[model samples]
Target: MTSSTRNRLFALGALLVAGAGLAYVAFGNIGQNLVFYWTPGEMLAQGSKAYGPTIRLGGVVQPGSLRWDAAHTHLSFRVADTDQPGAPSVPVLSSETPPQMFRERIGVVVEGTFDRSQTFTSSRLMVNHSNEYRPPKPGDGPDKWKTTVSAPTAEAR
Candidate 1:
């Protein structure tokens, strides 16, 4: 090939290599930031394969399994895939305060790593509130809905 042709071909090859390098770096960064969501059952099913890396654990907070320190800084709870009997549950530990809407039987998504002890140590906790809203049924008292807002007391007047 001619000298000019050779130089043009070399330049084109360099450009392709640079493009590929850029694409590689972009994908590497994306993978590092990506966090996969898994349920307790799925995580357990993965066995030791799920131990490393930060992930989001999604499940319902098991009733009567929630415990919090008197200072409210440390919290522990069990997350179950299903509320039905015989369903498996995963224990979770967090140092942060639980969300305002967090309570037993509510759905929660916690971002953290699973330890060798089978406990998930969460760095972040989020309450998953449902978007659906339903009105109170007829003949039901206001107290039936624990979330009903109470009126102001006379002492505040």
Candidate 2:
């Protein structure tokens, strides 16, 4: 091969190696960063493999479910699908302070891992108020009060 061709080939090989290295770096870290969400039923189905893997538990906050220690600031709660009638739920324990919106019947996303005893130890408590805002009714208008209406007086001349 000529000198120019040899240099061109060398550059092409370097570019290919750089591209492969970049691809590996990008894809290799994805599994570590991505978190999977699962319910108690699904986690039970997967058996012990689900243990020690960081994941999010998505479910409803069970009513009257929070028990917190005022002095120690320790807290615990149960999560379930409130919409599904009589569905069994999972218990979550956390030492961190829960979000303000974290209440019964609300949707929550808890992140952590489980142990051999099947207890889910949550490190983070994220309340999900994922509902989109709806505009007020047209005629039943946005304003709560009637500004145009006047209070009745004794004499209007």
Candidate 3:
């Protein structure tokens, strides 16, 4: 091969290797930052494999299972797969105050790690509101929606 051709080939091979290395590093960082959300049942199904990495748990807060400290610094609750009765639930403990919208039977996503004790220690809690807009039921009366809508203006004096 000619000297010019040999130098060109060497440069092309170096470019290919550099591109591959760059792609590898980009994907490696993405894989490390990709967090997954799992339901209680799904996480429980993982058994011992679920204990290490931080994961988001999505579910409904089980009714009557919430216990909050007086100072509002600590809270614990059981999260169920769904609002339906008898659904599987996992206990969650969070150091932060529950959001104002957080309430029993509402959907929530808690981000944290599951410990050997089977409790999820969450560092963040997010309330998941339904996207569907529901209108008031028939015969519910306008009073039921007073808080959601502004009152009608009285005639100007």
* Clash tally for model 2: 0
Question: How does residue 13 of candidate 3 score in lDDT?
Answer: 99
Give all TM-scores, in the order shown: 0.62, 0.57, 0.62
20-123 per-residue lDDT for model 3 (tens digits): 99998887676544545788988899899999898999999887777766565678888999988789899999986565667778899999999899999999
- For candidate 3, report its TM-score: 0.62
Can you write out model 1's per-residue Cα lDDT over 1-157, one digit (the tens) per residue? 9999999999999999999899987876765445456778888998999898898998898877777655656788888897665577899998766655677778999999997999999989988788977776887854552342121121112
Worst 10 residues of 3 by lDDT: 148-157
Worst 10 residues of 1 by lDDT: 148-157
Instruction: Report the Cα lDDT for residue 123, model 1.
Output: 88
The TM-score-based order of candidates, best leading, equals: 1, 3, 2
Among the numbered candidates, top lDDT falls to 3
Error at 156, model 1, angstroms: 33
Stretches of candidate 2 exceeding 4 Å from the true structure: 1-36, 83-85, 132-157
75-131 in candidate 2: lDDT tens per residue?
777788563656767888887777554555778888988878767898888877876
Superior candidate under TM-score, 1 versus 3: 1
Error of 2 at 117 (Å): 1.8
